[model samples]
Target: MTVAVFDHEGPWTEEEYLALGETSQRVELFDGSLHVTPAPTPRHQRISRKLGNILETAAESVGLELLEAVNVRLRPGRVPVPDLVVTAPVDLDDPYIEAADVRLVCEIISPGNAATDNVLKMHYYAAAGIEWYLLVEQTTGTLRLYQKRGRHYVEHQAVKRGGVLNLSAPVRATIHPEDLVP
Candidate 1:
């Protein structure tokens, strides 16, 4: 049986949020609120898996770890799950990862929430002190890498389908946008 998420009135606490347990949707906590994301399309999943494999290689080469869709507690009361996260290996059993340990966060832009990924998450990740942010644009088969500058992100690289994306920070990764789709 499914439980009603909004039965109580005030903002959700970490305890109350944790009580929700696992669900079919992607749920995140942002500023004492619950944000639910629909399960991604198969095409979106394919792209995420391919890009994850590519990121895995890079992360492993540098002795870091790559995790997919894990909760990252950015601050005292904010958490947002990114599509991919890279960091120094830590205990996987922990409730959530603290942002300071995170080296990078990546989001594969989704159709309904492109702006959220491009704007909201970019700012959120930066403010959380994550050093790198990578955005994948599936519709155009392109990728953009941004490096945190103070409280915001500055574009470090933009690669289209035919071009090669070479990243030197947070890890050294070589990605070809065309390979991300299939």
Candidate 2:
């Protein structure tokens, strides 16, 4: 089910990328290239929901909003849909959330697209100046939090199942890795 719809013959424009995303499948544009990922597995959805709930509670305390699977425009030619994000109030009329407005971006690694979440997207989010990034490794049931330092992300916390992850930068919340794996 995971597939790439376009050949790397030419770079795609932001308009073109947005058009392609109109299809039923989920697609992300990174460095002018299109990457299509399969629908999330049940485990992926469950983990996302659990993390969203935890983030939601923290966001409520901080007066931010929690969004799931929303299109984030990191830049002109880069749009990555993060699994979950915490941001300031968004205007419904806007087409996509801007990177500057994002407080934290969370990606729950899909088995088929681990590299995209672990490496590519991490770099992109950092380059876009997103303050915080959370990566949940589905296979290992581990949670890794990264804070933007300079132009890249330096690992802040790495917690395995049964371990606790405490966040204080973007928001104040304590999450257990065991709660993230269903």
Candidate 3:
């Protein structure tokens, strides 16, 4: 009942989530709840940087942009700072990226966040109709690429260490799984 006071359908409103602003920790809003994740390990960051470089380079030719840990508003009350996002050209002045403009969202799964990346986020991104979803599992050095299929995601490809991930949508890129490690 009190949720109506926020004037939003969800328990948390976009304004309330925005009020959180930037924080030291990784805070994602989902269904009126907050999921706070501790900072990623240095190793995690390194992988994200390397993977981002590959995607960014390829995305440029297609007029797409790769952003690291940028706020992506999946819906009115849902915002997740993905590890990397491939989006169509957006206004630099905007504080957040809209789901409609996003082509792909990448997440580097670390020790504490496997479930969130593998299940929760996949659901969110797929439901948002993001064209692609890339998941890099830190421990296994594996990469899984998913494509949206009718409001859900289906595995498009999977590669392990010493293997390559090639995708044409979002951007044409070849990624070597080994490069994602320290």
Candidate 4:
């Protein structure tokens, strides 16, 4: 990736944003602006890792690839790094995964960025034509699965901590919301 300085400016073009070098903080591009978030907490990381493991195993059974913290170029001027993603195999040399290759994108909501994950990112993913979007709420350990329908996403299933989320679209898997918690 080409390295350019981030000036904390607004209305950045996709080219300008991608040219910026990687920073310690997590960064995303949305609506021509850069949104930077602090590093996740230990509890968040643990939940992400556990969910990734579960998804990876299920993806492997169906010949899909499960990726964690991968930069997905949903569209020009819109790049969001989801917590976990399931996709068809991508070229190893590619700088970012194309939205077309993505089957499912997930975000494990952080307490500090709940709105971004639950609302902003959800709309972005749906607009990108991603088939499935999974939202994991950290506070309550709830898993919500959304399926794309035309220009929006509809809630397909919702499971609480004690319930099981059995998904049949994009891939097949039985996931427990409680297992996702640290």
User: Which candidate order results from sorting by TM-score in descending order?
Assistant: 1, 4, 3, 2
Judging by lDDT against the true structure, name the best candidate. 2
Lowest-scoring 10 consecutive residues by lDDT in candidate 2? 2-11
Candidate that would win on TM-score? 1
Off by over 4 Å in 4: 1-5, 8-10
Instruction: List model 3 lDDT by residue over 1-182, tens digit each.
Output: 33322234446666787877787888788978877777899999999999988999999988889999988988888999999999999997787999999998999998888999999999999888898899999998999999888989999999998888988887899998988875
| Consecutive 10-residue window with the lowest summed lDDT within model 3 | 1-10
Q: Count steric clashes of candidate 3.
A: 0
The estimated TM-scores of all candidates read 0.94, 0.91, 0.91, 0.91
Give lDDT tens digits, candidate 1, residues 65-132.
99999889898778888999998887899878889989989899988989889988888899999999
Worst 10 residues of 1 by lDDT: 3-12
* Cα lDDT tens digits for candidate 4, 1-182: 96544655568887777777577888888868888888888888998899888888889889899998878999887888899999998985676899999999989899888999878888889999999999998889999999999999999999998899998877888999878884
Backbone clashes (count) for model 4: 0
Order candidates by lDDT, high to low. Answer: 2, 1, 3, 4
Local error of candidate 1 at residue 63 (angstroms): 1.5
Show pairs that collide, candidate 2.
none
